[model samples]
Target chain A: MQPVIEVKDLCKTYQDGLKALDCITLDVHRGEILALLGPNGAGKTTLISIICGIVSPTSGSVTVDGRDIITDYRFTRQMIGLVPQELTLGTFDLVRNTVCFSRGLFGKRSNPAYVDDLLRDLSLLNKKDQEVRTLSGGMKRRVLIAKALAHEPRVLFLDEPTAGVDVELRKDMWDIVRRLRESGVTIILTTHYIEEAEEIADRVGVINRGRLLLVEEKHMLMRKLGKKRLTVQLKEPIARIPESLSSYDLDLAADGSEIILTYDIRSSRTRITALLQDIKNAGMTLKDLNTSQSSLEEIFVSLVKEEA
Target chain B: MNLEAVKVIYRFEMLRTWNTLMQSVASPVISTSLYFIVFGAAIGSRIQEIDGVSYGAFIVPGLIMLSLLTQSISNASFGIFFPRFTGTIYEVLSAPVSPFEIVLGYVGAAATKSLIIGLIILATAGLFVPLRVEHPLWMMVFLLLTCISFSLFGFIIGIWATNFEKLQLIPLLIITPLVFLGGSFYSISMLPPAWQTVTLFNPVVYLISGFRWSFYGISDVGVGVSVMMIVLFLSACLALVWWMFRTGYRLKQ
Candidate 1:
């Protein structure tokens, strides 16, 4: 299927000679959540800003649904919603008024019912009449989302949605995101939290120093780059591994009470059964055994580390 | 023409005015009344009529122009600059609305405000002096053109300002001084020929003169010249605004 958002070799350089983005190429498919994982100033926000038309690209092109972002800005912008990382809001405006104003700003006819439903979905219905300044940080963030979604855009770009939110609120935000995806809205979010991406992102893209290090399916990436470790608790304190198990990549535990075997998950032959038989043949009994696969966080750290 | 987008911005600004009734509406009315009390009732009682019009009556157009110019710039500049300051301008910048629509909404609301205040001041002046309009249509033309032109200028100021101090700079330092020295209270004919020649350099002189001519059939410059000058100024402001948007000056980074 054609991607909902297409970015090709996009670049942005500020007047101060600082390069914010360099040769970024990406595609966001419809109704899928693509999480962009990066540290601060990793060009995540800048990339999102360019696609949303908040910042001009120094070079290259972007298209939404096959329409150029610049030449067909009105159509592209109308179809995209951006919830910026900052808590940008008018302090005096009522929550409902701001959302309605956003709808009108997008040239949408007034629809109070639609706005009320959006507010309710964001759990902001109770505070719709309250001034924006009166709400807590989490509520203000929800108001931003409501404003972004007010025009009923087909795609949503959330820049660090849960940066400063508490854990409970963060989970709530993730649920809201899930519901949005279920409604067939394409989502592209930038996040500092690895767990946020792991928990909700269908695909993850790692960026560092203005370059896209890698973009791949979350589970597939873990399976490909991830490693699994098998720990064997010895029945007795063994001095070392037996010569028969020398072919296996093994490490003796610090206290000689356990032995760890590291192996590639992608390898067709794990030789686990042979290793166990050999351990019994060598008279090294096992008290307990467990295995763990590498996590997305570890894969992310190694990717970013390798880039740096 | 994204009329709905324009309406949204215009209505949002108008709502702010309504919410701050005291500062937006009452303050201008009360201040115009005070100007009449001090400059008209108190001072005009001592001076003789000039150009066959009472000192009090002759100053009415100038006073209205004064308020219109300052208020137009203030209203429009603050309308846009406040959003930029608070970071809420992202909504405007990121929206599908065009630059022209944004300017239309903001400048339209600002001019409407100045126009309302100008009319209120006119009515207020009537109570203090016997008002006359030799050319009522021309009077309205001058008032409207001045409001729109100055409001456009104010919109430029809003975009150019980076801080609160810069926001108040042009209105307080430059615009107010020009209005005062532009013969708002005295006719340029009353001055020596050389000073009159120098005073002609002041753009506000043409605006006040044109407006005063509509009221009393007297002016320092031809009514045609006044109209041309204002149109020239308005066109220049429009060009600058268009360039600002095209280049995404400070609005985009």
Candidate 2:
């Protein structure tokens, strides 16, 4: 399928010689939630800013729905909605007025019914007439989302949407994002929260030091790079691994009461049966056994560490 | 041309004025009325008229010009600067609106506010002293041109200002001083030839002189020179604003 947004060989270098993005290329498909996972200052905001036309790229190009962002900026921009990291709302404007203003600024004719529906979706209908300053932080965030969607944009960019939000609100925001996707709006979000990507993102892209390390399907990435560890608790304490079980590369617990073995889940041969038979022949009975897979957080940390 | 975008921005800015009616309209009127009482009534009672017009009536155009210049600058500057200051400018920059559309909305609203205040001050001057505008059409022309040109200048200042201090700097330290020295209270002819020549260099002189001529049918300088000066200043401000938007100076990085 043709991507909704295409960033080709994009590079942005500031005047002070700081390279914010370096030869980065990405494609966002229609109606998919693509989470850009990165640490602070990893250029996630810069990438979004470039695509949204808020910041100019020093070299390379970006297009939205086959229109170049620079040459056909009007069409491209009209199709996009950006929720910046900051609250960025006028303090005195009414919630409903602010959203309507956004729609109007995009050259959309005023539609009170549509705006009211958008407010209701964000749970801001009650605060529609209230000044923005009167709303709580979460409500303010919802206001931002409502404003972004007021123009009925096809693609939405949320930069650190859940930053500083409480867990309950974060969950609510996730539900909102999912609903937006269901409405056929492509969503691209940048976040450092690993679980945020793990929970909602269909595909995840890991970025570090202005470079895109990799982009893969969330579960596929997990299953590919994920390692499973098998923990075996012996009935009796063992001082060390037996000579026969040494080939299995077993690690003894600190108290010598448990044996642990880590293997790649992708590998065809885990050698679990052989290890179990060897343990039985060695006269060691197993009290209990359990296994756990690596989480996205651990994989993210390791990837970032490798780049560093 | 995105006229809708322009209208949206214009309406948004005008709504801000409506929300702050006291500061936008009432404050300027009250202060200009005070000026009429102090300079036109109390002080002019002792001083004779410089031209055929009354000292009280003669100062009307000058006072309006003074408020117009300053208010136009402040309104436009703050209109654009607040967005940048509060980070709300991203909506504008990311919108499908062009630079020209953005300027039209902001400068248009700012000029309208200044024009309203100018007319109010004019009516107030009539109550204080008999007022006569010999060429009412010319008076409106000068008033409108001054508002738009100065509002454009103010828009440039808004984009150039980095902090609140800088935002107020030009209006306070530069434009305000120029309006005073530009014959807002006294005609330039009252000064010696050398001082008069120096005063002509102050751009506010042309604005006030042109506007005052429309009232009394007399001017220290030729009416043509004053009109030409205004057009030249307007064009220069337009060029500078165009360049600023094109280069994204202090706006986009």
Candidate 3:
């Protein structure tokens, strides 16, 4: 499938000689959720801003569905919707009017029914007539999403959509994103939360210090970097691992109450059966055993550490 | 040009004005009426007439022009500046709307607001004194041209200003003083010969002179020079606005 957005060798340098984005390139597939994971000031917003035409790239180019963002700005911009990180709203405007006005900004004819459905889906129907300034933070965020979707854009960029949101609102946002994807709208969101990307992103791109470290399928990335650890509790405290268990890479707890064995999940032979047999043969009575797999957060920390 | 986009922005701005009716409309009208009361009643009592026109009538055009120029700048500047201040300008910048459409919507709305206030002040002045438009057509022409030109100037200031202080700086320190010194209360012809020559260099003089001429068929400068001066200012403002959008000055980064 043709990518909905293509960015090539894009770079941005501010007037103060600060390099915000450096030789970055990315592609967002149609109807897929691509999460850009980065620390603060890692050029996530800058990248999205360039594609949405809010900021001019210092060099390189971006195209949406085969049209250059600069040369064909009107057409390219028409295809995009951006929910900025800032909680910017027309304070005195009614929720309904704010959403309708956003639709008109895109030159779209008024579609009150669509807006009504959108508001209902976002659970903002009750507050439709309320002035924006009166709504709670979460409700205002819903308004931003409604406004962004009012134009029915083909591609949407949510810059830190769930930042500072409560857990319930965050989950609601995830559900909303899922629904938008179901409707065939391509989504590119920037987030620093590893769980956020792990939960919803089909593809995760890691960025650090103005450079994209990697972009890969979330599960594939997990499988490649994931590690499994098995911890065994001995019936009695042991001072060290038995001589027979020397072949295995094992760590004994400082108190000698448990043993931890770490191994790559991707290896063809886990050798678990042999390890269990060897453990039984050594006359070590295992009271209990628990296994845990590395999470995306661990993988991300190590990845950023390696680059640093 | 995308008329729908322009309409959206224009309507949004005009709605903001409606929401602040007292600040946008009533205050200016009331203030201009006070000017009619003070300068017309108090001052007009002593100086009965100037250059064959009643003192009260002569200052009518200047007062309207004064309020029109200041209000036009303030309305347009605040209109655009507030969006930037609130960071909502990103919405407009990111949309499919072009720079021309953005300017047309904003400047157009600002001019409309100022024009309404100008007409209201005119009507209010009529209640105070017997006002006459010697050339009704020319009066409207001057009113519209002034509205558009000053609004455009305000748009530039809106983009140029980075904070509230800068926003009010030009309108208060520069334009207001220029309007006052430009003879909003007294004709430049009434000044000494040397002072009159210097006053002629004030750009606001031409705006007031041409507008006053439309009311009384008399002016401090030739009507042609007045028209030429306003057109020149209008072109300069247009050029500056064009450059601002092109370079993304203060609007894009």
Query: Pick by DockQ: which candidate is best?
Result: 2
Cα lDDT of all candidates, in order?
A: 0.92, 0.93, 0.92
lDDT tens digits, residue span A1-308, model 2: 89999999999998889999989999999999999999999999999999988899999999999999999999999999999899999999999899999999888889999999999999999999999999999999999999889899999999999999999999999999999999999999999999999999999999888889999999999999898889999999999888989898679995889999988899999999889999999999999999999999989998999888
Q: Rank the candidates by DockQ, best first.
A: 2, 3, 1
DockQ, per model, reads 0.85, 0.88, 0.86
Pairs that clash in candidate 3: none
| Model 3 ranges off by over 4 Å | A242-249, A253-257, A266-282, A287-290
Q: Kindly report which residue stretches of model 2 are placed more than 4 angstroms away from their true locations once superposed.
A: A237-257
TM-score of chain B of 3: 0.99
- Candidate with top TM-score is 2
Across residues B76-121, which tens digit of lDDT does each residue of candidate 3 receive? Answer: 9998999999998999999999899999999999999999999999
Ranking by TM-score: 2, 3, 1
Note each model's CA RMSD in angstroms.
2.0, 1.5, 1.7
Clashing residue pairs for model 1: none
TM-score of the first chain in candidate 3 relative to the native first chain: 0.93
Query: Candidates 1 and 3: which is better by DockQ?
Result: 3
